[model samples]
Target: MATGDAKLILPFNSAFSSSYWMRWQTPVCFLITVSPGIAAALMLYRLKRRRGCDHLPAAATWAPCFRGVPPLVLPVYRGLVVISMISVLYCLLRLNGLVEFYFYTQWTFLLVIIYFLIGTIISAHGCWVYYRQRRRQGVEEGNRFLTFNRDDNVDNHTALVTADNNSGGKLEDKRAGTWGYCMQIIYQTCGGAVMLTDVVFWCILVPYMSSAHFSVNLVMGCMHSLNLLFLLVDTLLNSMPFPWFRMAYFILWSCTYVIFQWILHACGFSWWPYPFLELATPWAPLWYFCMALIHVPCYGAYWLIVKAKNTYFPRFFPHSYVSL
Candidate 1:
């Protein structure tokens, strides 16, 4: 039945052609395809209005202020949302037979684009809710730690301070320790490196790999999965206050991914980005297991860096930093 439908929708020669129309039609197709997403967004907006928070803060607003650095939610969301809209447009064009040439060759691209747009929109909405709470409570603008009184001698090291920085006395801005600052720099560096590498791999490497019969959709899926996993871990680590809770969250989330991968693999599917695992000769599950293990060190390094900043450079990493 699927085969008959494929033939009806896509012709033999048109399916395999390599042309500009095939490659570039995605954005136009995505715009037309995003009706469901638009509908969903409108529905959500109406629901929120009905709940009585007319001026509710966006989800990005509640993102934990890492020291003074506002969470990088907006940029990420903007990029993903744009890509998703493009994907939706692409799907619409393909389904409607708007692009005559090479339609079959680009089917996988359509699916990948759709997956990304949907996933990012869902995740971004959750983040929006988080920031809204912070904005409404006024905590979004204050230091996450060390509440102080204006009348107190804030300079005195002997005095204990509240984390909220809202005590009756003037708040003292404590300098972060040298190690903490160093960690912050390292975390930022690592985060940047990971993102840059992933982008390069997707935009450049994947096309080359596809020449060898690599599944682009599969590769994209894996990459997106990895990205989601990393972001989830990073968010928890940076947002949580206590070390124990941070570690616990990391473990729980990591285990969840492990289980998800395992189940998918057992069911004859590969759901992660590191294509090396799927490309292995023996098809060992252990290879995928090891790939996941790499996250431990990556996250561990990130945690160490954040921990150092919090411990050493408290003033530099104030909790009150907000970015629009």
Candidate 2:
């Protein structure tokens, strides 16, 4: 019942666009979005059911294989997470309240926030483990030094090496656990979601809808920009491997949102958040198909960034950098 450029509309009880569901475009739009969702769902199911198919190395660790990376990286990264979360929350507050959460931008932003929160907890545990291992190694080395008997000292050193190997094996097993998989999937999903949200908002919505339905403000700008900014910084810092197969999860994420919109409209909710999503238009099929195809480049671009970092960093800073 909102008026003017409010982007709200009366439910089905109000006057209908007679052509809304009557056109051939409706089913075409449905197929464009939902078919990929179905295929992606099946792909994920098989991935989980099949052994050796999905290898989720722990993305939570500062450096998975190499301990030479400074332990301070964890604490500093946690500080960045806290700052990013606060800024996003402030922007949400400026947009009014929880009602703003209705938009997909907010959904993706919230996912990024959740990822950071989970990351903070995991990284804190890593910091404790790092310092504890350093202390244990120092104490053991000191005890070996006190034993001047060279043979006995050698035996003690061998025992320490064996124990370290056992602990490392356990850590590798932990990396394949369920929580590790969740973190990796969330990271990949956020990669695609943020890209799509920003691109559509700035390039399409801002140009076309700004004069009529869309309002561009500082808070809205930050919501779009900061989501990608924070995620990009995390990608640069974290040791996570971005396997391209996890793009299935990204497709599923967007599909769920599109299906949600369809369900709302079916239930007599009238508002279409973006005009291209409106099925009443004859171009709806074209828009939906284009949206579907755009996922590839959106995700591929982020993948390329990660690939470039891994390829170039080790060469440039051979002493300091470690590629995942």
Runs with alpha carbons beyond 4 Å of true place in candidate 2: 1-19, 64-69, 139-174
TM-score per candidate: 0.32, 0.81
Error of 2 at 45 (Å): 2.1
Over 1-324, each residue of candidate 2 has an lDDT whose tens digit, in order, gives: 011224333345333444456789988888999899989999888878988765543434444323345655755775686676668666555445565655788788888887777667776765665556556666554232112232442221111111265564121223435666677788899998899899988888777765544567666777788888888877777767787888999999999888888776776667777777888778889999999999999999899988988788777766655443
lDDT per residue, candidate 1, 232-284, as tens digits? 34443342222221222233333443344434444444333334333333433
Candidate achieving the largest TM-score: 2
Question: What TM-score quantifies how close candidate 1 is to the native fold?
Answer: 0.32
lDDT of 1 at 140: 37
Against the reference, the lDDT scores of all candidates come to 0.37, 0.68
Q: Give the RMSD in angstroms, all C-alphas superposed, for model 1.
A: 16.7
